[model samples]
Target: MNENLFRPQFDALKLSDKLWLMQTLATRYHLTFKELYAFSRWGQSCTTGLFEKGGREFVFVPGNTVILGWEGFVQGMDKANQEELADIFAEIEYEGSVEGFLRQGMTPVRQVTIGPMFVGRKLEEIGWESVPMNDPRITAHPDWLDALRKLADRDGQSLKIHETVRFERNGDSWKAWLCHPMTYPEFQRSLLWDLAASLPTPDEWAYLCGGGCRTLFPWGDGMDYSMHLHHFESPEDEDKPFDMEEPNFFGVSIAYDPYMREVVKAEQFTTCGGDGGRGICGGLGIFLGFLPCSPHCKPKVQEDKELNGDYDFYRPIIRLENHD
Candidate 1:
């Protein structure tokens, strides 16, 4: 059997032909296909869609050729967006700090071909198999007062976002979450067992976030200052809630916040996004704060100095390459 029958060059197919092919894919693989891209000043948006397995959802990123890295903050992003970002620059310190870092040797540019993949929309939480619960699940628990009290009692007054899961109990059933910093092997083992998926590569992570678009953020180049980016200059600012990890056009949530460094694959032992909340809480200003979301940023993953920091998370992806 041709394993790659599910993968096709969508750009070459005509509109009607595309629809016909999409139908086969839908019926055969339980995948839904959609054309979400068009040619533009920077480039065409990557074709992204959706699929489901194990009662969980995933964003399907189609295969395509794309430029992987670039030189300057304003280089890959088009002119109009450059102008917009410059205005935001005026509100914060530039020359000595963020600008110097940006001006330095940026992520080296090179064209690369990426294959289709299904990316998880949310970070994976561990420890579901322990109790053998029939309906195991995990979700954000902001108002978990009992768990909060227990956490504070065990650790300290402040609510930490680390290994501890805030589990809620019910008769013969329970749910758990808040475990964002699981090691790669731990997540890999669970995910592969559950959905036959694993974490994404650095390049795949880039495509998931930027989708080959020459823009700063996933949606576009300009930043929406209205959304809190986890960067704070004062104690009062820290009080503000973190932005919800919303899905990008590809239906995956990634590279949005600098505080959460998502664990990546390979022998090097590195992460794809974030500085582990260092820049966000370090008074580094807004530019450094939001830099994690940009695909062009170099040294894509660096070692976080803090010990077993709560800033780590995992994003599992199912590669659509030939099983043969």
Candidate 2:
């Protein structure tokens, strides 16, 4: 999860290209390495997710922990001139499926990305029918669907006829893309095993899993919930820990891992109704030798300096406005 480890990976890249990639990512995510590590609420961990947006393919095989954030891990991974990195950019250049693209290689990459259109085509091929009502898992929240429905129902809208269909069509593709693996859960489970099997040793999986679990506190409540965005801003009053017998209604819990010098704690802030309940989940953990002077450590602040100028380059491309 250490970003510095990735420096060796990118040794062949021109400095400008490296900086450009860093800036593009920071702009897209609205994240700084410091801010990310100091404020990741999901606990300390590493996980990989793949995405194919519009016609673009990206294999974000992230190895981030609470300490190293996405920016750090990305820079680390890009440090290499490996085929994995080349494959990532090449498929993204052409419209392609992550799994399909990776299969072309002997050692397939860990993640997969089938974008909206591709996923839609698969759904049609499968003959799956739509649910009459929106389910919480399908939508980030009910209101997220409601907002889109309101747009479709606007007066004089060409979408008036079969408005639900319009709402369903536009959003379903993206949801399908996100949940595509869920449809083939067994297949994906096999993938996990394949990933474990391919690792240098099976024991490494246990080490990674143990390291990753320390990074996320499961909100195991059966109810569907969204990760509240307000967790990142200013801190508010800290309350006494909840009583053990009291029902845990809050969405997530704090996770601290001493080995990583990582601390994942939730800081209180307002929630849904502005009714003053606590749900501002913030995660900030420490990494040993984040500062200079420790063995095998260097100041990661250099990447920040390199990224400053190009940080907002992605704004016009796919940046979502006003997410907060």
Candidate 3:
């Protein structure tokens, strides 16, 4: 939120008024415009009548700091450039809306593209409904298994036996983890803020593992053992799952670990980018010269009963509408 005091009024706008102030600050920060059109001038071609309607793309982190396009794959801009690019966006001084800047906590950052559509299979084709909860084929109907066996007999050993369970469908209702015996970082950060209408902070996981390029790993500083990594060349490959490798410029594959994802800022909980080592659960580790997979490592700082298991996974960040 400290975008260097609005960088000289966003470097004195003009590129079509800075693309209409980045489509009016990405719809005042709820962000979801999949395509904004009108570029051309040397940037090749692209002209779809300057915004008529187009939602569900989510990743325009203009001033909440870096991760807009390109690395996330050409999200439009140019339109003949009138000037202004002073460090890519930062002027909208919070006038209201976007749920009042997410009730003052403010957040918007996305970028992790590289290849083989990874961030957990593009958060499962943009609907994110995992719920492996330790597998056993994941059944749940005898009245939700007798209400989870009376919530594991009224929370005995602090529940979370094995844990995995992810959800987020929203049409016929299937949102986050309905509570019951769910605990840890407050019901998995309130079931990932009710299954991703937004919730991926920790500075958007440090701008998607350093896309601002301070380098340590985000495709730099060397260490490309031929791409598709995993336990540094095979530490007894545990069946290797998750996006099968090759992604980083923001498509975000198994970024380096066997599991360790759970990110959020104001409501607390923290852990970021790095997996496939704590005994490999779902392979594909994006090499970063080893050691807690760089990009500023961050191995500890988890407490809400240590979030849960299967490497504590989590990934969802939608916002095509529904500000609830």
Candidate 4:
């Protein structure tokens, strides 16, 4: 009867209850304890009711308690980087040092118990249902192909529905290719609603990416320009692998592209991961552009409020009550 959750996900439960649910699901699915724990502290990921459709995978972020602020990392920061960050903050009109500005609400380095969570995986190639050109959803607009192509991959990668689908513009047998990305917003909503998963909170997100570690990026604080648009800027580099979104320690692709703003579940900012390329895209150079890769980076600006409604990069998470 001790059915209480420590963090609303796993407040509490008697040993029997934990064993019961784990045994029930694992036994029926032939899942081992390690596999069962996958949705939690271990295991890359295991499917559950969360994903109703599509191929977007999910991973388990185990509950943990650690200092979730910049205080623990400031001393190790290089003096020049500190100065650089401070300058960036000053340019943004923040009154204090770069560290002080970042510590605004991320301070106190208190102990936080993030219960085990199942997070949405941002894969390199998510399965999208291509839309047929002749589908009734198609309007009579001749420019639809060009405009939609803008949204698809430019070089024709995973999001490249525009590049792959062949159409003669005014051809008679005009039928479209894969599912339109325009449908992704509505489709993603329904999936989230059905799975009972919501976007990960900043802390939850930070942990998922960096595991609450002091490193800026989940891998390290170093900046790899090859991971940015700079890698793909040249004509000859067109076929090169952008090499973005490598799986993190948890095997979940959260966010890395500075241009692609990722949405998060937070009262403020409501956005994390990248800074919309304001740093590098703004001509500030790679150092600033790569800052958003830091799990702790705060890119909230005046217009960030609109991200939740329009942004496409977001990782949804479901809280499990049996977070042992």
Best by TM-score: 1
Query: Which model, 1 or 4, shows the larger lDDT?
Result: 1
**Candidate 1 displacement at residue 212 in angstroms:** 1.8
Candidate 2 off by > 4 Å = 1-14, 17-54, 57-213, 217-324
lDDT for model 1, please: 0.57
lDDT of 1 by residue, 3-32 (tens): 232335555556566456445555555555
Each prediction's whole-model lDDT (CA): 0.57, 0.23, 0.38, 0.51
lDDT of 2 by residue, 1-324 (tens): 224213233333454554554445545653331111111222333212223433332222222222211111211212232343355446448455432432342121122211110000000111122443445444655654565566556532322112123223444332222112112223223334632211111111111222222111122111111221222212432243322112111111111111121100112110011111111211111111111111112112121211111110100012112321
Instruction: Give per-residue CA lDDT, model 3, range 38-131, as digits (tens).
Output: 3222112222112212232333322223442112112222322111211211243434432232223212334542211012213212212445
Candidate 2 positional error at 174, Å: 18
Candidate 4 lDDT, 55-120, residue by residue in tens = 445544446666565553432455555666667766777776544544553434546667765566
Order candidates by TM-score, high to low. 1, 4, 3, 2
Candidate 2: C-alpha lDDT: 0.23
Better of 1 and 4 by TM-score: 1
Winner on lDDT (2 vs 4)? 4
